[model samples]
Target: MASKVTPISGFQEWLPRERIAEQYVLDTIREVFELHGFASVSTRAVEPVERLSDQGEDADKEIYAVSRLAGGDDEARLGLHFDLTVPFARYVLENSGKLTFPFRRYQIQPAWRGERPQRGRYREFIQADVDIIDAAELPGHYEAELLLVIADVFGRLPVGAYQVHVNNRKICEGFYRAIGIEDVIGTLRIVDKLDKIGEDGVASLLLAAGCSQEQADRCLALARIRTSDTSFVQQVRALGVSHPVLEEGLTHLASVMETAAEHAPGVAVADLRIARGLDYYTGTVYETMLERDPGYGSVCSGGRYDALASDGKRTYPGVGISIGVSRLLGLLIGEEGLTASRETPAAVLVAVNDEETRSDSIRIAAALRSRGVPTLVAPKAAKFGKQIQFADRRGIPYVWFPGAGERGGDAVKDIRSGDQVDADAASWTPPAADLHATLVTPGSSD
Candidate 1:
């Protein structure tokens, strides 16, 4: 039976050109991650439903439950993981004995969420995550290091003018407690909506959540504190609230900002309102925003979780940040028309002059490929113009015509400029820029 074709609202599928662009981004991320000494790891897509539900912040409501379509009875409940962190925690617990302490790993995978889809949100999406985990104790320096890692990745990509907003749960918890608000997590959950809901809205929600009007106003004031450097410590002090936890948070955040300034200046900001809604976050939290489009929401976010993974006798503490690959690409490729130099990786298409000499074309392609040039033979022996058109349509810059030169050797044409020159398949090389697919954005020179 023929199946009906339709576009799923939240499922993202890209064309050949867009896929090439995405692969370029993914490759860049993997390269940077490996260069920083993060080992790659992957976990199963489905986790136990109870495990998924146990994650805080209403995560259970968005979990996609999985059940056998044709099974007898007594099957365990399972669900597609909504995010990588939960599964990673479980992995740490299961492999605690086999793995070494202070493990540094990178995981790039797709996660499913059954929440409402929006401009940059999808039901299924790819998240590239880097985390450093240690048994019992994780260094505060790792929090600052993770920020630098993100900065390194963004610097290598075309993501323009972004900042990693850093905050600490201790900051929010201590501030709330100082103001006599007992439900720190619940209050943070409401305050996390400050961006979605304005100050007045958050105030109302806070008041409704058992906070006095004075307390709600104070919370809003704290959420509004944002600074580009360690000056935020003084600013928080000026709020006139004092607590041991708040003091501890201020010292930690200052160290993070100071280290970031020395290493990755202008890329880190101390934004107190970034209370990552997840309940697991115990200390540092991060949310990244592209200055060009802050309304697009955080393209990368994560934080420190001290007790998310514990096996009664031991605890694994870690810090991680996730880049929303699908969300970022959806904005760049789908909305802004970003793409790759060509649909295929081939930089030079070896033209097939005639069916009898097709073997010659294949041999030429092999020679060029052997020399590290991406080369492909034309599929059919058509007119030179038609063959060239095929290459042009796919953005293939150079096309090789066998026996077209005066010496009956070979000639390559730069389709963009209509320049053809005699060349040898064994020695000819495409320009470095043309060797692989290059990204083409709105402002790109290509």
Candidate 2:
């Protein structure tokens, strides 16, 4: 019988090349993060439950509290963080004095949530996060730039086509309040399900949340309009513009659109519709989708949260975006045929010439490594044919053979193209382009 087994669902472990493909997604995001001048920082994976309580943004429902099997009476609890943004906010508050203002940083780490997992959702998943924090107030340009960074990352990635849908919290909440809807978060929670549930479902949801028939109609009416540019203001203004909250919403939408056109143009648009699920976002909010596959849920999303973090003395305003790396990797590699390599980690393999010259094989592998090529020596002194096959199976591009008689120093075989030639380990190269991995981007799918 199999060892008494229990498998926790929604958790996954990666093998060699699968992990390489995973790293490709993460590493791409890191490069994009640094290119935009954001510094790098990582927070402890667990934080005191108090720091991540219901006081912040509303959705901490899936927090997993830690426990030790060996028990003690002094009780303490910590939750594995749900998202990078909250941990980052606490970090900024704790070290505010030592750090510079308007902190820009990127975090790449795993988070835990006990939610029922599905195709792209997980009990544990890594998020690539970048946020900008200011001591007092953050400018509108920061809002525009944040979306631009997100688009830049998505644009460069090897995933399918996508667009970032942006909205201002003030705009959405104000519009709701102006229309006399009291529970805006409740309304947003319903609206957030619109893409998943369709128009009628959201209408029913709003009605269930005690919104008036006219108010629900207006809300669904607003959610119906999706545009590539920011002209959403004029159309929404045409809908009905008597309320101050609606008026303010239009103005803020105009501001974001104007700035996006002037600076990070065309990356965002005012979807009078984009009522992101969270309540913490007080200003601009974002949701990105693959144009062809919007129902797969947002590939990246975030918003501006004003006054969410405070140093007991002053408030720290923040705005940023996060991309689901594993989520995208699953789609790209699994569905889109966007794979880095199916091979194990080695880049090159050296042939072993029996027991006598295993040392020679080691020397050749070392020489290849010194030339900036990752190399591995064959496990045993075996026949040249078997050694070559080993290199072939592992996706190692070049195989090296030590010269036996007068065949020269080393022989290099290009496993991919089946071209074999005499090559000196120190002087010869397998082409510069092949030496470095090519990053697959959205352009590749076309």
Candidate 3:
């Protein structure tokens, strides 16, 4: 007897209809990325353990180490990459000589992490990432420009009423130092938990991490600043903090909000509390939330990395954003009942009258397929009623009869409407909408 098979936790597996929905989301993202002139790139799945060791204090625990069952001691240690950014940074350093300055690229691939699974978080998940890197200083304008690309992508997708919350790390770092907090990274790690622990919980953690009562109160005050326009700059200044880095951060984020207001109004928010847990983000960071469900966590997030990668001679500065494709679909398809119109791609099923006449059905299917229709030949020479029932069972809208027309020609019946009309296999076409399977969201019109 075979050992019983069970699902490995955190590994997402979708059925055929759900898979089609996932592909639709991916295709929309790829189209928007290319529309913005970002080239595509793919990096290896496994990297040397030494290279993956420095992501952050808590990253190592989430890494899934890879090893051969019968390997010898001389073999190199390797691990599956937890995210695309590290592998991408290594790729840039390895190919610096061949790549052009201000290189723009997009990557859609699976990333592995050995973490406990939650509603939207998974150990094996797909991420769609777009990044812009330069050999030297990357322009500040690109920071704001990435928001437009993200807005365009979400606009084309079915994800409704989303906002991309933007923040600058310099603002937090500068303000922390000006208030006598020495461990900026530790403080950031704590403040980043504001959403999970609440303001009081975060303040307790901050105090435990060596913050005075006034300092902890000031930190929470900074995190509470949220706005939709450039007014956030004045809000930070009103808190009575003074540091060159804080001033610079306010200027940079103000510029970003100003650009967003003009090009993609009401889509970007200046939320100072968005401290992405990753240590690599050096400047601006983002966290996207759905208006209907802010507690679902960020469905898309990334940020600027002035020192993403560096060789002994040069450094690559860049900024990027990644859409959590798996997470978004979990809410849309798994919970919200988003799905495709049909289980299969076939739009028209060619019915076989009998075994001898099956050749005629095959010919009709071939002709229809040659003309761009998704046609399928009946598997068996069943009765006409049975064949029509087969098509209906699979959600195939039309059933083609090889020679049931008024003359000795082909005819197709819309199974839903019971309307049969003469159609020439050589030239007949289904309606544009029926040519391909379409996404169907609950409560949305067909």
- Across residues 1-446, which tens digit of lDDT does each residue of candidate 3 receive? 89999878887788877887888899999999999999999999999887787877688888889999999899999999988999999999999999998999999999998888989999999999999999889999999999999999999988899999999999999999999999999999999999899999999999899999999999999999999988888888999999999998999999999999999999999999999988889899999999999999999999999876898789999999999998999999989989888888999999998999888988899999998899999899988899999998878999999889999888899998999999999889999999988998999754
At residue 121, candidate 3 shows an lDDT of 90
Q: Per-residue lDDT for 195-298 in model 2, tens only?
A: 68888998998888888899999987777776666677767777774567666656766776776677656667667577776667777788887778877877
Per-model C-alpha lDDT, please?
Answer: 0.93, 0.77, 0.92
Report how far residue 397 has shifted in candidate 3, in Å: 1.1
lDDT order, best first, reads: 1, 3, 2
Instruction: Report the C-alpha displacement of residue 196, candidate 3, in angstroms.
Output: 1.1
Least accurate 10 contiguous residues by lDDT in model 2:
437-446
Compared with the true structure, what per-residue lDDT tens digits does model 1 show for residues 352-399? 989998999999999998888988889989998999999999989999
Global CA lDDT computed for model 3: 0.92
The candidate with the higher TM-score, 1 or 2, is 1
- Give the CA lDDT, 0 to 100, for residue 391 in model 2: 80
